[model samples]
Target chain A: MPKAELLDPQGQAVQSAMGRLGFSGVVSVRQGKRFEIEVEGQITEERRIELEHLAETLLANPVIENHTLTIE
Target chain B: MPKAELLDPQGQAVQSAMGRLGFSGVVSVRQGKRFEIEVEGQITEERRIELEHLAETLLANPVIENHTLTIE
Candidate 1:
């Protein structure tokens, strides 16, 4: 089996924080969880990227969330 | 910093496991990592996706590796 890191959603995701209009405000801490995926094929480089795109666009919440794919 | 799962490299990552060549040979477990990012801008929807793409293409390894972007 190949390896993958699924970016699942977390509770109370902090999207942004207020700044003094001086700091420009930063996304202090965007948090998320991960899962495992068992797929088919050679796990080629191109397929990996394609899979990642699928994760971000479909598996994950595009509105306020995103996922990082990890292969081992 | 903005929450970002950096798909960093791990040692001896198991990409696939052999079955009787039967398990159809699956990608059993793809592993990856997460990190924090502090960027400039509103962290808008488009921006978030853009950031994720950057992570996948540049920050992450395209071959035998991919990263899932998570925004909290």
Candidate 2:
């Protein structure tokens, strides 16, 4: 999830636009990015670990973002 | 979520970069945006419906993306 208030500019802009479009009461909003990866085989324990490492090191910038992995 | 292969270029580039960085077996990757909104009050049934409509019409572009709302 994105750090609260960090996405303020973009989130606030979107909120304002939504309000103008008749969507009010949205106290706040935070926006971030999501990634879905299709691996070659079953997502085993080792693969999960590797994906987590990759997510932290490559997909997300630890300084301002966080990531999660889910199988579906 | 972003349309599957639609995120190909960016995703593939990330995957390739990861491989070079010693992380392999990631057959494919799809990247998308995530939005976390903090509403003003309790998310009742009516609020949920309104949020859904807002997400479909404003937060996400139906033509090429999908979204989900969760309370946390």
Candidate 3:
């Protein structure tokens, strides 16, 4: 699984989004280190790019969010 | 000098406390990482203890706060 850690500078909105996505209680945003998501590996580079797009567009804020992905 | 980074799980109070203490905008509680304080070297261990006490009691939330001190 690849682990994605999303850091949100603006907490409330991120929390709201998580809630909207039905990931409310599962996600924790403390400090700048907000949500940590573990996703399955994709078969192709295109899929990886798609995953990244999903994370950036839907899971995190592009303006104030920072992310680190670790393949484990 | 010693650098103390205080992380507050509850952002509003930390911001309030820092504001009350005149720390105000210097403190940033984004996500969970809050204020960063830099203190001068103490002459004795007693002084170090005193400093720690001040930090824990006043600067952070003992219930949910986390801090790291670095002497530099």
Candidate 4:
């Protein structure tokens, strides 16, 4: 399995919302998108790298967001 | 720090898109939202639970999505 998350650079809206809701302890919030993927076969090292590239090129917009990949 | 992810139960659109993109090895893709929160102080056990409830009630739609919390 490959999990990819595309994170926002700034998340002021959510942070302020939490503050208004009385959860003032929340200092910051960065919103993002997560994609859980199931692949057909064993995920080799090369395949993992390929998936990271795909996450950057297709699943996430590199200009406004950053992505991280985890294999499990 | 607290991280929450709201996950979609069904993920057909992304799966199909990956298939069309020549990534036939990808069997499934479930899209979701990820929130990274920075808190003002130490996250105690009670605070962690409170955050989980907040994630379920405010951050994610219980009818269509499920949420998971991670403390880091």
Give chain A TM for each model in order: 0.48, 0.87, 0.41, 0.77
Q: For residues B1-72, what per-residue lDDT tens digits would candidate 2 score against the true structure? A: 766636557777887887898866777777777887777878889988888898898888888887877877
Encode model 1's per-residue lDDT on A1-72: one tens digit a residue: 111243323211322222321233444433443446667756888768766765665445766555567776
Candidate 4 lDDT, A36-61, residue by residue in tens: 88898899998888788788888887
**Top candidate, metric DockQ:** 2
Model 2 stretches with alpha carbons more than 4 Å out? A5-7, B5-7
Question: Residue A13 in model 3: shift from native, Å?
Answer: 28
lDDT of 1 at B10: 26
Evaluation by DockQ, superior candidate among 1 and 3: 1
lDDT, candidate 1, B1-72, per-residue tens: 112243423211332222332233344433444446666666788777666665665445666555667665
Sort by TM-score, best first: 2, 4, 1, 3
Which residue pairs show collisions in model 4? none
Cα RMSD, each candidate: 11.7, 2.2, 19.2, 5.6
Identify the superior model by TM-score, candidate 1 or candidate 4.
4
Which should have the higher TM-score, number 3 or number 4?
4
Ranking by DockQ: 2, 4, 1, 3
> What is each candidate's DockQ, to 2 decimals?
0.19, 0.75, 0.04, 0.53
| Candidate 1 positional error at B37, Å | 15
Residue B6, candidate 4: alpha-carbon lDDT: 35
**C-alpha lDDT (0 to 100) for residue B69 of candidate 2:** 79
CAPRI verdict on model 1? Answer: incorrect
Per-residue CA lDDT of candidate 4, range B1-72, in tens?
A: 112243334466777766777777876678877887889889999889878878987888787677789999
Q: Indicate the DockQ of the complex predicted as candidate 3.
A: 0.04
Residue B45, model 2: lDDT of: 91
